[model samples]
Target: MDVVLVSRTQAKLDATADEIRAQYPSRRVKCVRADFTDPDTSAVYSHVGRELHGLEVGVLVNNVGLSYPHPEYFLKAAEDRCGDADGGKAAASAGWGPQLFDDMVRCNITSMVNMCRLVMPGMADRKRGCVINIGSTASRIPCPLLTMYGATKKFVEKFSRELNTEYGGKGKHGTNITVQCVMPGYVATKMSKIARTSWLVPSPDTFVKSALQTTGLEPVTTGYFPHTLMVKAIELAESISESMMARTVMNNMLGIRARALRRLAKEQQQREEAQSATATDK
Candidate 1:
């Protein structure tokens, strides 16, 4: 079995490759460093074709994603980080300007679609392949502060479901291509900012292991058992009253946003003090 690890960080990729090599000495582990945020990511497809040559990719994991530095309202995030969405005003004049949103679109949506485009045809021809897309439980509900992220993940959920229906089967004309959308609630990963693994939040390896168990069983899942439970609870709550659920989630997000802003303010103050102290010493 040949495994290809693609990421923006070379050191991390190398470390992962080493770990995989250690686990399966006979299996080949390859690492490709590519920034999917860039338009140049299209080039990586060409590289894959050249490097893998006649070999078929039996599994493809579309796991690359990007979220906000911290949760905030869509308008606030758009204006503060991606320039003026309202108008070319001073309040939003000095920021990332549409570029951040563009990058997110590329990373979350375009990259996944492009990867499926690159590998799905071959899988169809071979009549065997598995595509696992990492979605989020955020997609299942209406999250105000995490609007854009949730929307993109919803896209993944819908896309994966349709793709599986379109290609997954063992019939005479079946493509035999399996597409699974794994929606995780929370995992103890850098992205989740959860340092400790708890009943609710599992480690990435544990999450993946659990998710893999349901690959051919379900086209869409919460992946981890605990996460599935969490999702079910949320679904139950939503079933009772979606408005109440939305209001409850909105209140929770508002609190998180408040705390994040406070933390940022504190950090900025600390930085300013450090600068002042340095100037005084100078």
Candidate 2:
């Protein structure tokens, strides 16, 4: 199997490629370094094409996405911290500024669309391929603070569903292309701030292992068993009333948002004090 990795950092890409090579010595691994936030996507696509020049790519995973470092009211985030330099970093630094919004859309939505466009035609012609789109539980559930992010994921779910129906039907184009949308609740990842894995929150590898099993069986899946149960519970709760279900989710999210805001505030204060002390010393 040939694995092609694409990301922003060359060093991280090299390390990941090395790990892949070490794990599967027989499999060919290629890495293409490109930042999805760039306005010019043509260059990124061109680089990816160049890297995939020789291989008959069988699987395409549209896994890249971005979210706000912490939850905030839409208006509040837009009005404040728009010009902060720490807009795109991890949780402690990320802010939902206008530029950050653009970057998020480009990274999360536009990249996936362009990648699909670049790869789908070839797959359709060959009549054998798999496209795995990584969506979020936020799309399926009611998430107040993560409004735009959830909206973007909703687009992904819709897009993947339509794409599968159009190209995956054996009767339509006689194609065998599989487009699977995997919406996960949470896994131990930097993005989710999940430092430790548990029964409910499995590791990425564990989630992927379960997700792969449901690939042609379901068009959309929660991926992990715990995530699936969580989605089902939410759906069951929704049977009472949409507003009640939303309120329940929103209330829980409010607590998370409050804690996140506190962490960011404390970190910012520490930075200010450190800078002040340095200036006094100088």
Candidate 3:
């Protein structure tokens, strides 16, 4: 199976590619620097798989994201963080504090939609493909400080389910593209190094490995550990809220989240300084 992983950081791309190669030595695994945050995000990267490689994309994992340490300044930081991907004029209309919510909607939201749009034509042509969109647990419930971050992921979670129901019909285009949202509770990545102590955190690879397995089942796959089971057995459970809320108990969960944030930020600073020194040939 030929696979491509679109990652923002080259280091992460290399790590994931290495693992895939070790597991499936016979299969081709390609890693591309397709940062979703880039204003010039395009679908051609995905098209390259179908057109150039002579391989059908059996799976697509949309796992790109960002967040602010403090919720108090989330709106303020987002406007500057994200430039105008929607439009120069519409940016002001958004009425967000800085960068129209401090970041580019094009990268965060529009680009994902465009990628899916591009891949669907080919997947529908072949009647096989799976799209796994990595979202956040904040989408299902809510996190006070993670307002916009949560909202953006919520849109993605909702989109994947609808796409599964609407596009998976065999009659329309004879397509069997499985669309599933792979939202995780918390994981130890560079971004969330501050969120070090998640009750049921999985490594990046572990999270992807499981989510990839459930591509064809349904839209929503409850995030975290037992939560994933709760999603599958929602109807059998006594209450919808009771089954899912155990792992992500809120304030208690984020008890140490603030301190972790400080540590991660310090680590980021040291890395930046080291990179600068190296650039000067130190």
Candidate 4:
């Protein structure tokens, strides 16, 4: 059983590769830098497969994501950030917050979509392959502040489910691809070090390990253990009230916003300290 990890960051690719090598010694695994942001970048997947000599990618993990780094607004966080009640279509027309959203869609939504397409043909031809779609619990829990990031993720969830159910009954091209969506909580990556969200932050190792645990299955495991319980608790507490769900989601969003802001603050302090040390050295 060979594994394929599609990601953009070189450092993450390296770390993930090392873990795969050390942990899954019996199964040959390969890690390749896949920058799905570009339409032409998917060739890297095929190139890597060819380089692996005798390995064929039976398992594909789509773990690429972004928050506010994109250039357009797929999902608007601030009503005032966009336009009219019709979801700021006018604002987007006027170039208010569309750029970031579009960029996010490309990264969060489109890129992963391409990965699925790239692997489907081969998997379908063989009638045996698995696809893991990694999403954020943030989608299930409304993150008002994350704005476009949340919306793109929502799309990711829906797209994954639909794809799974669609080709689930019958294998396409003789290869039935099962798409599983994994929504994790806050993970401590370089970005996490800059922004600490109390929303069940886990180390990348833990998060990915859990994620790998249920790759072929659609298991929406929260990033933190306690937070996972909170999801059930929140659902039960608001189980009677449909409105409560929205309320709870928003409340969670507020917490996330605060945590994100605090992370930024901590990052700022670190930057200032580094600068001070440099100045002293001079």
lDDT of each: 0.81, 0.84, 0.62, 0.63
lDDT of 4 at 20: 82
Question: Of models 2 and 4, which has the larger lDDT?
Answer: 2
List runs of model 2 lying over 4 Å from the truth: 80-92, 279-282
- lDDT of prediction 2: 0.84
Sort by TM-score, best first: what order? Answer: 2, 1, 3, 4
List ranges where model 1 is wrong by over 4 Å.
40-53, 80-97
Q: Please state the error at residue 138 of candidate 2 in Å.
A: 1.0
Which candidate number has the best TM-score? Answer: 2
**Residue 262 of candidate 3: its Cα lDDT?**
51
The C-alpha RMSD of each candidate to the native structure, in angstroms, is: 3.7, 3.2, 8.2, 7.2
What TM-score, over all chains together, does every model reach?
0.89, 0.91, 0.67, 0.65
Lowest summed lDDT window (length 10), candidate 1: 86-95
In candidate 1, list every pair of residues with a backbone clash.
Answer: none
Prediction 4 global C-alpha lDDT: 0.63
lDDT of 3 by residue, 1-282 (tens): 677776668998899899889999997877766666555444544543344355466677666666654333354345543223422322222234554443535555665787787667778778888887877666766465566777888888889888888767567554777888877766667767634544467676666666656656657775456556544453344256754554354554455444444554566567778989999995
Q: How many clashes in each structure?
A: 0, 0, 14, 14
Compute the lDDT of residue 262 as modeled in candidate 1.
62
